[model samples]
Target chain A: MVAESARENKRVLEVKNLKLHYLTSQGAVKAVDDISFCLNRGETLGIVGESGCGKTTTAVALMMMPSPPGKIVGGQILIEGKDIVPMTETQIRKQIRWEKISMVFQGAMNCLTPVYTIGKQMMETLREHREMAKEEAIARIEKYLAYVGLSRDVLKRYPHELSGGMKQRIVIAMALFLEPKIILCDEPTTALDVVVQAQIINLLKDLKQQLDLSFIFITHDLATEAEVSDRLMVMYGGKIAEIGTNEQIYGKQGPMHPYTQRLLKATPLLHEKVEELAFIPGRPPDLLNPPKGCKFHDRCNVVMDRCKEEEPDLREVEPDHFVSCWRCRES
Target chain B: MSENIFEAKNLQKWFPVRRSITDLLKRRQSYVKAVDGVTFSIRRGEIFGLVGESGCGKTTTGKMLMKLLEPTGGQMLLDGQDVTHITAERLKTYRREVQMVFQDPYASMNPRFRIRDVLEEPLLIHKVGEDHQERLKMVARALTEVRLQPPEEYMERFPHMLSGGQRQRAATARSLILNPKFIVADEPVSMIDLSTRAEILHMMKQVQRELQLTYLYITHDLSTARYFTDTIAVMYLGRIVEMGDPDDVIDHPRHPYTMALIAAVCEPVSGKVNRIKDVPIKGEVPSAQNIPRGCRFHPRCLYAKEECWTQIEPELEIVEGRHWVACRRYKEI
Candidate 1:
């Protein structure tokens, strides 16, 4: 029990049955339905799925802001053993958001104000958080900027003056300014070119090791996810399809879930010569009117009749590996 | 007749930059060298991929071929006939022979029109069909070609009602309604979902094979370029840095830029997950307005030498059989 407690202490964040729903005029859209996962200290967890698969919703939920009409219906978001589900927006801003967990949003480079210099916007973030001297704040900003491989000269330049890669770096630098334990990056390198994307990915990896920061890296790009993530979480229809280590998820044995297996085959690999790439037929499920049973049953190739009637629970298939599939459960 | 269907000799498109007040006072003129000098040829029924980063003139080259943008200089030969300065009736005929599928299917399509109307409009423009009934049959045939099944069900639906993948298929159908011998597809699968990207590519390949149509596939994605195209040309700073078989150019890249691009691709294999990649290249692509005097890629190249920037620009030269590299230090590198 003592050893278990000690191991539990190493966990930075633990989510239990997290459910985020977007209440529409039609009905309540279960964007993130009853999903549970944990992020360990100094570990990078990659959450990957297709568009509208609730990956971004989960990220927003973790940050305690789930846009309008979306709410954390039920669940315990335990950060360092303290539940943050009931925390108010002001409370989250003061104590949790950016102070303990920060986020680098998709296309965040474009979010940088065109009217203001990069330094001015970063300084505003610093000023809003705590009571620090202007000199000290500037010094901190410069330190973080250097961490992201940018010089002090960039501080004087506006967002328009910088390239896409440079702007992304600046956004990453700002994410690190708070020195948060966990950073949520959503498609941070999607808009970038192949070479520039590699540079940014390398920079993020370097920072992750140097700072021992935990990350929730979300992207639809499987290859990029493989490069950075220590653990992989495949989400489909706002539910956990499979969660395992890189080896377990991408190993020769392959993923347990049908969706994951197909998704892996769908991605084109550079090293391997594939005669024909596999593709999942049909579109993603509509959250407003999700299927009766397993969310992926409509598209799953190995789907049984039971899968159309009952959703399977996320069960431990191996040590540190979890799969939510009737086939795996039956096996 | 030669196997080559389309050939471009030193194609160039230089857009004049609006003169600033300072430049106006100084009596200076400048141009954004969008496509300084690009040269390549597409075979009779081969998918020729023009791959590059954003400002590298791949799309501009495609536009020049599509005649969407007129080139400032150079020659374009279609089937051994010079069509560079063709006007009026010849241009319309060129349009009929060479169709273009744009990047965004969502934006390219008219939201107000049904899928049938979208496909039929092209036929009407080219005056390919005799009447509305004949045009409808052509539209159905085109839709069937792209695997949008039953044709009748999808014909009545608006663009907004179709999914992204379906819309892209519809766009492809629209491009094929005219039965063009050549299709200039600019990043056709980039905007679609990951699961559907392969499907769209597969459909396109099947269509290309069935119809024996040539394609000028322009995209920044090297992986898709490798999978989809027979020949690949790596473009850099308004020039063809490398051109060869898709496998040769991608797997055994001769040019430094191509090497960097291949190195940067995050392979999805499980074995390579833990491998830490040292990004071989440095800095983003330079602006086209102020291209370097010698080699444009000298600023970011790891093996760059003094002569790379101070000497005359390198031109495409044969490195191996059917493989070409433009770097002066290709042999040394």
Candidate 2:
């Protein structure tokens, strides 16, 4: 779906030569290493990676949320074809933040104030966007809650009264309250149960269509990401390892990178059982002093001599699919 | 049934909650049914998973089995002894028979104690602290039993000193220190990182085999449930909705709720597969305090009819070998 629309409007968000680093006492930790990609309007771009791959930092840089110790050393974040990385905090706050693009922060259940009622919390966002009476806001809150499939009574309860899933629903409701064109949700359902997680995933997919909302869903769970995302961008050590549709990103389009291939074989699905799940042996590269040639050279199974000495830039292997692995060309 | 090591009957735990400050002043209280009537059994060397979201009372069930939190009602017969009506002497005798692994490895182990002190404290409490040298020897052996290699390095580490996996291994060493017949591991790996989560699961499976420890592993993760558990029990709002072999329950989930939960988790098989628009069950998990009259899952269930509302509760009927489902429409599905 994203490939079809790529020719239409180019992309709402164009990330080019984006490099974010954590300036630590030990030295610069290149969290998001030289990543580049673009996202079309109303398309779900699922970013999959483990803990410290700069995926979260990518979201922070795009939203201009990263402050202090963590610095965006190099990058151009283009929203609506306008570069946003170098914008001051004030311009981003008044013009861009939550107005053009908004984010449902990771672990949103804890995002709500435990003391306030849901109604008051929803009104906080509503008041920031537009001037409305308390009664008008209350009625709109009930309507938005209904859109997220929750009843009006949820607004009457405290954050402690709501379950983890309910708290997530409220977050989605808040993300949509201002009705920004693009929404970024980071590991939205990690704390929820499986059944409740399913509900949240379905809600986002349905809302993506109904509201014509664009979403950048970041997660470690590749299975659910495949279910919801139109296109997927696989990130490793802050670089774009692969970018393609779900069919291309998942095992379908031949994975040029051994890391992608190994990750595909390892994840445990619903029906199948294995004697042992495949593990991508060895940890991710230390960002401070990363490997020289290919970033994946250490963990790659079919590592060639050339892969050890030369880093390959991301290029089209097939039609729409792109990979940065040196061995990809041979494959 | 042949491997059944721990059997529980009518397990119940009730917590009294005062309605308000005024109600507390008036000395009025009402029972919050944290864990209502529940019953299940776990097999020897088998990972019997109890899957549920929070407030479904699965944790309460695990606590009741361990006798950590005193149950207001019910009977627990471990390897054949009724632990419901036991005294301090009897409890001390039963202490070595049953052991529990808590959720947070960080908080579970005492912050003040070293790894050896924490493990050997149980042995000491049960009056096995006499042979300090031999207990130290057993501590090293217990650490190895749980797959923590070269136990000497781990002996001096406190709860804060080690990684999550190592801390959990240290905690498991504490549990296995007594060489208990049954281990109620209540979300032991929940707090660990995803990378080491599997290592802890693999290590627990090995510990189960090496020590003949029967495990009632409580978790919210279904893929691990499918991978590790021999039998699985899907709990909802303090009741078992489905119970049977893990393959039977996971593959051909009889209950709608079980099917939804499995679908929610259980990633699509690794391949460039066509995406299916998942119809995530639309609704909130109704409060345990306000359970629906008939089927607990009726509120969000797609196939619910009027009969599912205010009528008799569906009894657990045998569907196939070792498979029991508590829903009337299971046959139709």
Candidate 3:
């Protein structure tokens, strides 16, 4: 109980009832509907879901980007005990963005400016945020490059000169150059080869420990998430279906939500051998016009009539474990 | 010989790199040895997996098997018939007996055409049936074979109307409509979602079983390769470094590259995060154009010795019952 209180005190980021919608021609696409979670200082919270599950939308909302058609409808995003939802655009730009939180995008090829050299790109960020002199920024960039295991000679090279793994490390270094409280990594290793991917994951873990940085790592791969995250959040459609400790989420017969359970079973494990994998029968529910009750009701194996009529709240079923299924609550 | 329906003997393909004016003045020539002396044979109904990383030439090997790209050296046999020296007319017949399913379903199909046209194009080209109505019946049967039930619903829909999985299934249906004996499916499930991957793989397996079609399943994912293939071959730098039972190769890898590949797979299991130590090598995959001397993996091999750099190319040696490895330290390992 004392440890739990200490963790609560270390809450670096808390998202409460956050709702983001996309104003499309057909209707208001409820991309993120009433999702809430807290990220403890130095802790990695992994958000995992299929395509169109609003995982990326939640990350973008945290970044406060003015992506057209996507707007934050409501909710409190409290970072360091201060509500950021009501902050002015200039305040968000000057203080909240990059100073507190930054994002590492999916593909490194698209993220890095093609025409600019590595040193020039790093200097732009440092100069804009810290107003550091060119000489000082160059020195800082060299130091950051060393931290990410890149040679200072890479500073002279363009983005195309670097490999995918090197480009990813540079992107991470840029995100960390600001020394933000939290870093949002959206599928950082999706495009890399397996060996390169392992190297990146190890690098991320090392950086987290050395810097005491908190991470909101988002990926569709659950196994990759298990490697880094302290807690796991499983989202289906637009709502979070389950959230719990890594052990509670990935333990033997641990995932309580049917969608989470099926997802785990569907993934092919390297060590384990099974006759066949159990796949979720139907596709993810249409977010443009979400279902009436539970978003996963159509695919839930143990679905009841009540599931189709009433949406179950995310209730704490066990210590530090939350599930949004009435059957799980009863059992 | 009777059971071996498809055989590739020391297949080789070298892609010539584009030369600049400076190189032309200097009279310099360079080639990327994409498929360097690859040899394998697939049984009549076996799923032979060619597993490797991006530049390892697995896709090139698959393309060669489908005759989409001609090999610069060696020969291929279909039903004990030599295809390398076949006439254009004979090659067309050979192509009819072989088909290919690409990696990206979205890019492989024609967006403007309906599903019916996509499936019927192959039959129309091969002159499978006398009447267009007869070809439509064949299309329906092929669609049903791939589990795209109620074919009438999907027949009129364009490629954009279907999901990734549905589009891939339609591609598979189109490939099977020609009644090919062998099919090269290159990363068919890589682009789809995990939940949909198992279903598509199941459909492919079922179609292979029902039609007695041989498969050359090429993918960079080792876990899926192990789950899908019967006999697995691990490639590194355009060469087949290891070949054996998928379980044997993946569970107890002999080659350092294969070991590294298996160790690198990020599993979802807890406490297995730090399971892989040292990654068995250093640096990223080198460009295929500048492949290392001696063993292609010599630079990255953790067990590389002085002889590894200067020694002649190591040939694949049978280590155990049909398990082959091309490592110099195969005995010590």
Candidate 4:
């Protein structure tokens, strides 16, 4: 959460001239193109986008999760004034992972062992990173379980025995056991029920305040993101289309980017149920052979000649509110 | 006589405890009540939603309705015929008439089977059509019925070739080939993207209208179920806490569980931050193994009084017209 609170301090993470490319057989798919941002300590930076928008890929890069077709060809991830890209995988895993920075992954259910009990699994996590005796590890596990509102008895049960919400709690407990500086939550509450999702969201908020950790919450669901995130960064086709505070992103009448607006409108809510939400009108641009100029230009309704001919750069119109669009004429 | 296409009068399906090390010594086998005294009827040509959280017995209830699972006690009637104990000819008839559409579209369709093979397997199993060419024509009709058009293109392609939405449509087409009277759609569109969700939902609606089909849509998501289903039965820990018109349950929830569910989805009107405690209720779902005393939701329920803890399970009573809600606090609401 330090990365989140650093807004007042000026810089927690400064990514200057960032460029992530996927070295596929087809071609080098430029995902994160010259993206730059600073996440203050204890602040949430919500990277909202459609699937395959390089939002998730960027997170993986931040965690340095193995470069397959994807490679961070150029970028600098300065967390608490330290560069991560140049660091070795082993060093990142030892020093940075879970201790310095941790993440709650999307489609992350596989992280939990199906055979092991939630508590036992949690105890194992504590035992691994922290040099605690079995007794002390068990005590800490129980404390974290209680914090997430799961009983110590639940730790004895298998992963399959517990519900999705329960398993997610264990993951959260694991994320917090070491007290990481920045927590990257990738669609953390996607599969769970709404009621349960609320509980998880609240738990994150409470944990953030108590831990004073930074969160780079990655999610497609705008409603949940808006509820938790302090600031928002909208990514499209491997680029930051828009960036601003939470109120600026959600509280606005509409989004500056067409993609952002489509996502906001597409989701169905309880009270504001409309017939057929206006979609962006096309699938997400193919990473391989992506549309030239603006990746979203193919589907963007308010398209312009410049948008098709030249890619839009991230430009600041208002203070702290950054957007990328050739036709970003709205003041 | 106009019979309820599906009826469960006092239906209960409690899984008996197996003989274990402790159980063998104690000789007191504990039964896990998966579906306790669920009573509801799906009318012909109506979309009925069965919604609940995981392990709340919504899937179990649907499985029982599909006759994939036998009931521990009570009976199931399909068009005045008792199906709970059917065997031989009657069982085959019931199987042919009723079908199920599972949640995972990818798993539901056999990866090895082509789209044509997938849709035709049901027909081949039931021996519905006389000739192969005749069956092919019917498959085309089924695909068209589900709005999966230019049927020939989809027919030859394997399950892997199809997108999530298309594969789900193929799944619907497969179920439709049987010409079943009732279909239990267990969260059919939950796995797909939000953009294509509407098309699948609308297709289901269109198919239901054309085929005059009755559906038991089991899902945990309520926001879209409000727009999709006609009636909804909200389940909590193997029992229907509230059952009513979608509008009533979605808007005016009688049970606290249902209320909390609504509050969970309902965004704050004032745009002020959402509080977890203001979540209309509290606490995660209790373990299915050790259910809470009195009402299953009582442990988390805000209005849980002393009487709520000791009382036997509440009956599903008609709190209002066609709306059956089982709660001690229904009167207070």
Candidate 5:
């Protein structure tokens, strides 16, 4: 069914049974285990989880930087149905890294070289990935900068001279300069203030519409995920708990996965006033030695005998909505 | 009748920027007016939130309130008595009444010391308890109050042993150990994850009600402010652009800056993606050292007029019931 849907819409990226494990001295830390998803063209899929749930690790693995001590133990990452997991470093660096897919790193404003001018840093990406000449790269940078609301004079200024918002916009412009089909934005507006964060969100939306870009926006903020995402994936202990449209996940169709419901309740939504926020008790399970069955069973309010003994599989409960809870399945 | 427990009358903190050798050669002096003339009051047990983006002096204001940093101008009163320039002997009394909880949970507590020693140090300094047994009881009580139950289990653990949420709760326990009447909680929950934020906030509110403690809740997140604060003051470039009830100020804001801030919050509910139609203000907040002349927010204000440019800076004036705004054309806008 998923493959049929993928063929109907132009699937930009697809991951099947992807597993990433860190070779720690204690044990193999299953950071991302058996996760699968497909991103349609021009669609935004938001991956949200608490810290240590492997959201960022998945982004890093997708970037092809499964560093030493960390390895992709299983599964295929196909970009336009072409598996890039087996591709060598040189092949990935030359053909896949920036030309096909790129990333706007988390806290990326700090990644810019303080000594170099904005133009130089941006030009380096264009010349490296696209192999554009000096004048052409400069012109391209200027145009992209304008698209993100930066002036021409900003090209001459150093990283320290510009504000945080300006620096973030410059980083985004560099990411889109290659015209990549897929962009992995890992918490792009985490450190920025509210109004400035809005600007970056608006800019991303506009650029996505204009370029027909597919995005995997990774954030711990559920509200922000709802703003830009067509579908939302909730991950817990390196496994997906639930995946659905924004409406279905926000209690529109009644009960969801207990973890998802608790998360939506815990998050302070804009303009919504509540007497008290519902907090999910217990810490996220340790990845090194996970629980026997459902990772969230210990913290889940509705845990049953079956939940503690058998792991739930991700199954479609409704149209395009998948959940991994026995209770949800029974309902 | 509600009584004001703490009041700040136009507090100011101006730090002189050290002139570079090259700039000194040109004979120029500059100062970053970090907290310029901020004023607010906390009732006996209500939470007065000081909210703004970074560099807006909310942290500096909290520090000034805690007496950790002395203000360059203005006066502070505790129970109708001036505490700003109180004598050293009297300042000790003020310290007992007012305490602070820092933002970074890891850095706030001494890592080497166990949680028991950390909580007991404040009692030792103020000589609150007569004997070691008494201090231990007080520390255990504080721990239980913060919901770190079976306090004995956590007393011997170091800061590194606890999770971010646990460390923050321990920090809150440390603040409560002093039995302070007022606490300056500076971005206390911003360092923690969303899953743990609600618990910390709920604990804080519970403790406030039980202890009758006033809070100077400082944070950059408006949503948290709305959920936590009774009244909020929105700061912008070293000045408070708006101050009123959190619901009123956040929902029906008069100032353009406040409107922009409310618009910026991303609601998780669907169909509200394009709710914020126009960018109320243009560009990031200007440098505090070079605040615009007429209205500090005018240069970026969408409703800015000719008077907003050439006239003197607008003073904060009350336009409605308990709602104060600093824009000259606030009424018309």
Candidate 6:
């Protein structure tokens, strides 16, 4: 019991059996299905998958603000021993959201209002959340802006006045205004230019260390995710296909999950020479009516007769390395 | 005909910016130098990549090569013929030999048109086949060539009905229907899924090799450019700052801009997590209308000296065999 408490202390956020479904005209889209993971303090967990693979959905569900038609069907989202799943919407907004966890959304640069100055918009967020004076809030905003390598003058400028990279930095600063210990970044650097992307990635790393914050960095770009994540989680359809440290997933031993291995192979590399890039033959599964048994069974290169009949649970293949594959189970 | 299939010499495309009231009163005119004096030659059947970030005018260069946009200045030669400002009648013939594949397949194709109609429209425009039946046969053949087989099945489907990768393949098939000698593929795979990007690129590569077609592949992603192209030219502020083989340009980039770009690429290799990546250059790219004097990159260059901006802009000088850099301080850097 004492050991379990110590382990819980290290985890900043724990998600157990989290299931999110989107009700469409066709059917319920299982965007996130029974996924479980724990994010340790100051550790960055990178979630990678193709479009509609539930990377962004997972982030949104954690924030407890899944868009209309999307509902958190079942699961417990525990932050520092507090279960947020049972909390009401008003209660979650007041106590849970932006207090313990915050999110930097995909293409958040465009989220800034054009009518308001950067300072005014940031002040509104602070004013909505806490009882703070304008001067104190402005000072906090400036400090966080500086943390993201932006100058004080930016607060006076409108969203259109700044470049995409600068606007992204401002979004990051806004996420930090509440001083949340955990930040969920969903494709934060997706549309930015390469150089600017590197700068943003570096800034996130610096802030992670300085603030001692944990991050759920989600992106489809495997390389960028690999550059930021301490532990990598590869998701397919709506389930966790594989989860492990960078070495266990990307080292010479290679990824055990067929989907993860194929994804890594398909991604183009700069520093290495590849004679050919392997591509997954089929399209990503439609969540509305995903294939039977394993979600990735249709695209798996090393498929077995058993894989088609029974779904495999996420089993620990090595120490701290979990893979969901019937082949791994046989081995 | 010359061995070089298509050559662009000091090509320039400057779009005039709207003059303000003060500028009009002062009789001042400004231009967004989109493609400012870019010079390169595409060898026969070789893939030459034009790589740069957005607003760097790579797309403008591709448009000029395709004759979609008339160049404001400079010469464009095709098969030893100067065809920069060809007559409309001549352009029709020229376009038949030089096709273009755009970035977004969804936006590029007509939504109402079937796959058969999309491929047939080009053949009809170029007057390739004899009749309707003959054209349909050619369309089926083109579909087969792109490996969208059993061609008849795909031919009846609309663009929306097909998947992203399949739509791209259909787009490629449309471009190939006319059997163009030169193709300008501008960020063709950027809109597709990550897992399927390699498939599109591989099919494009296979088609390029089988048909012995020359391609001007334009993209902002260096990794894809490195994998797909035979030669690469790194552009900045509408100018070619570096040009050489993919190995030389990507592996041992000489220009400061190229070096910074390569450094910024997020390599998928493991064990690089949490490592602080230093993006050597600073500040965002300046507006194209207000390009810096002398060296266009001096504003953001880390090693910029007084002469870099004060002196005359450096021209592309041969560093070694087939490797060229426009940076004056390349040797020192």
Sort order, DockQ high to low: 6, 1, 5, 3, 4, 2
Give the per-residue Cα lDDT of candidate 5 at A2: 69
DockQ-based CAPRI category assigned to the predicted complex of candidate 5: medium
On DockQ, the leading prediction is 6
Task: Please identify which of the two predictions, 2 or 6, would achieve the higher DockQ against the true structure.
Answer: 6
Per-residue error (Å), model 3, residue B214? 0.8
| TM (chain A) per model | 0.97, 0.94, 0.97, 0.92, 0.96, 0.97
TM-score of chain B of 1: 0.97
Better of 3 and 6 by lDDT: 6
Candidate 4 Cα deviation (angstroms), residue A20: 3.8
Tell me the TM-score of chain B in each candidate: 0.97, 0.91, 0.96, 0.94, 0.95, 0.98
List the RMSD of every prediction in angstroms: 1.4, 3.6, 1.7, 3.6, 2.0, 1.6
How high is the DockQ of candidate 2?
0.36
- Of 2 and 3, the candidate ranking higher by lDDT: 3
Model 2 residue runs over 4 Å out of place are A1-8, A129-143, A151-156, A251-254, A288-300, A303-313, B1-3, B20-29, B110-133, B154-163, B193-195, B269-282, B299-311
Ranking by TM-score: 1, 6, 3, 5, 4, 2
* Worst 10-residue lDDT window, candidate 5 chain A: A246-255
TM-score of each: 0.98, 0.89, 0.97, 0.90, 0.96, 0.97
How accurately is candidate 6 docked according to DockQ?
0.77
Using Cα atoms, each model's DockQ against the true complex is 0.70, 0.36, 0.60, 0.37, 0.63, 0.77
| Global local distance difference test of model 3 | 0.88
Residue runs of model 3 more than 4 Å from their true location after superposition: A1-6, B273-277
Off-target runs (Cα >4 Å) in candidate 1 are A1-6, B271-275
lDDT of 6: 0.91
Cα misplacement distance, residue A210 of candidate 6 (Å): 1.4
Where's the lowest-lDDT run of ten residues in candidate 4 chain A? A273-282
lDDT of 1 by residue, B1-61 (tens): 6789999999999999999999999999999999999888899999999999988999999
Whole-model lDDT for model 5 versus the true structure? Answer: 0.88
